[model samples]
Target: MLAILYVSHGSRVAEGVRQANHFLKQCMDQINVPIQQICYLELVRPDIQEGISRCIKHGADCVIVQPILLLSAGHDKRDIPDEIEKARAVYPNVRFIYGRPFGVDDSIIDILVERIHEKHSGSVQNDSILIVGRGSSDLETPRAFSRICAMLAKRGISPVSVCYMAAAKPLLKEGLELAVEQGPGKVYIVPYLLFSGILMRTIRKSIETSVNRFSFVLCKPLGYHPSLIHLLRKRIRESIDYDRLSAQS
Candidate 1:
């Protein structure tokens, strides 16, 4: 039997962990697979090895490990894969397949649009968008972030800019300054994050401080939206197909 193991970058905040669990439950309902489990990368219970062990215990012959991350950063490239390698050594007989992380997808753009609509009542063209991401040291993630900004601009969201919370150039403060300089009627701060955590709190604090200087609205983090659920399901199905094709060849 094929089992699905959804892994997220866990948070220390209780609400963040709760949000992840809640999102996983929603995903479990939509996914067709019967054997599914969720675990965290760090700062939470039932880490990667334990998640895999549970799947094995449940008689899953092959396990599909899906990363619930927004970008292909260190976690996607090193940490998660290293954990899976360790698990493979422990359970030599169980087959493991890794899925790709979310990378500049249209559905993500849709989520950002939805967030904008939910938070702001004014016209989009008149407002500037400042998209914030949990910055990465990897060059690819920042490139992907730039792509997202370009995509938004193509969709007629004028004067859109992207910045990072950490590990990259043009941090959130700088991005906000650029947005303010645009002289738009209002500036919307969009967080390109999966769940609420310390980053979200920090973004909120930054916005609060800047509100006196310019019109700023902080949209909620990209939580368990239906679009995200669909994207994750698609990744899992694609991974399963790839695994089966590899096995046959």
Candidate 2:
């Protein structure tokens, strides 16, 4: 049997975890695979190892490992691969196919527009857009973020900029400070996160303490969207013959 295992960046916030679970379940329902399981990389129970065990118990001979992330960052390139390699050692007979994360997509950008418009739908001519991302050490991470900024600009959303929460340049505080100082444009703070959690609270707290607290508007994080389901389905299809191996080997 073929099973699909989704590994998401788990959260310490119970509500965040719940949202992740609910989103993945909805994604699973759309995929035709017989057995599908969801697990977290950290801060939650039933980690990657246990998720695979459950898949095996369900009689899965082949498991497609899908990453539920926004970027191809440390987790995608290292942590998840390390865990999957360990699983390969234990389940030598099972075929493992690793899938990709939802990289830059226009549909996602559309959703971002939705998020941006949700807070302040007024004229953006003099207004600026600030994208707050959960930064990653991976070199590709910022490049991808920059592309998002450019795409936003292409859509005529000008004067857009980005800041990171960790592991990258222009930390959120500095970004917020700069946004407060620059060009007299109201900065629309768009969190480039998947779900709501600690970071969301942190963003709120930072804004409250920042200079000209009312000068900024916070938009929703990129959360449960139908396009993500379509993205996952597309990625899973791409892993059709990826990393195939005979279980008996």
Candidate 3:
């Protein structure tokens, strides 16, 4: 059996656990193959270490560490790899595979497009789409949103802007103000969040109370979508296959 450790950008908020557990269960249902375990990175129970131990105990010949992050930032580039290394040392016999992030993948684009269409289906030209993410100071973090902007531009979507919620300049309200200044007939705000919690609720309320003529719709987060599962499966499968090839060599 194979163990898929879906590592998330853990949050202390209780909602984070509920969201992660929900997605993991959905993934379990989608994938018929035996899964050794599912785990988080931090700020919650069943950290990566414990998840790996469970996988080992469950007889995982090879373990795939899949990051549930959107981009290759500090956590993806540094923290996750470090944890995987430690896990590998702990389970010497089991081959440990690290998966790539969900970066500019087709599935992601599909989700974005769906969100835009869903929110502004009939009247797209007037409304500007704002792609908002949990802001990061890391340079790589902004690049992810930039890529999304580029994708939207290519699709001929006008008046689209990118902004962060924290740790970056031009926060959500500022971004909305810019969108208004840009003279978009209507403004649509999309939360680039993985799950709903206090932050999401606050943002939604802010949009609803202060704004007029601007329609703000909260498209659901990437919740147990088949494409996400496919991305995970591909990453895990590649790692396992590569290890097999290397062993044969």
Candidate 4:
């Protein structure tokens, strides 16, 4: 039997964990797979190792580990793979396949646009958008973020800018400053994050501190959206199909 393991970058905030669990539960209901489990990369229980063990106990001969991440960063590339390797050592017979993260897709762009529209009901043509991402040291992640920003711009949201919370250049403050300089009627801070956490809180606090200088509106993190649920379902299906094809070949 094939067991799907969904892994998320766990957050310390209680609401973050709640949101993750809630979202995963929604995915579980939509997925036809009977054997599935949820795990966290850090700051939560049922780590990767435990998740793998649970799969084994549940009679999962083939395990598909899917990272519910926005980009292919260290956690998706190294940390989760390393944990899976350790699981492999323990269960040599069980087949394991890793899946890719959500890397610059139309659904993500749609979600961002939806978020922007929800926050700012006024004319976007006159507003400057500041997209905030959970920064990564990986070059590809920033590039993907830039692509999303560009895509947003193509949709008529003028002067769209990208920023990172950490690990990359053009941090949140810098992006906000640039947005302010554009002198838009309003600046929208759209967090390109999956869940709420310290970073989201920090964004709010930072904007509050600079509220005197410019008008800013902070959109909620992209959490538990239907588009995201659809994206996760697609990833899980692709992983299962790829593994089946490999076996047939």
Reference-based TM-score of each model:
0.94, 0.94, 0.86, 0.96
RMSD of 3: 2.5
What C-alpha lDDT does candidate 3 achieve relative to the native structure? 0.74
TM-score of 1: 0.94
Best by lDDT: 2
- lDDT for each candidate structure: 0.86, 0.88, 0.74, 0.86
Worst 10 residues of 1 by lDDT: 205-214
Cα lDDT tens digits for candidate 2, 99-194: 999999897899888898898677788888999999988899889988998998888787888899999989999998887676787899999988
Give residue 116's error in model 2 in angstroms: 0.8
Clashing pairs in 2: 93-247
Give the clashing residue pairs of candidate 3, or none: none
Residue 5, model 4: Cα distance from true site in angstroms: 0.8
The deviation in Å at residue 236 for candidate 1 is 0.6
lDDT of 4: 0.86
Candidate 4 accuracy as TM-score? 0.96
Model 1 stretches with alpha carbons more than 4 Å out: 211-213
lDDT (Cα, 0-100) at 15 in candidate 2 = 91
Pick by TM-score: which candidate is best?
A: 4
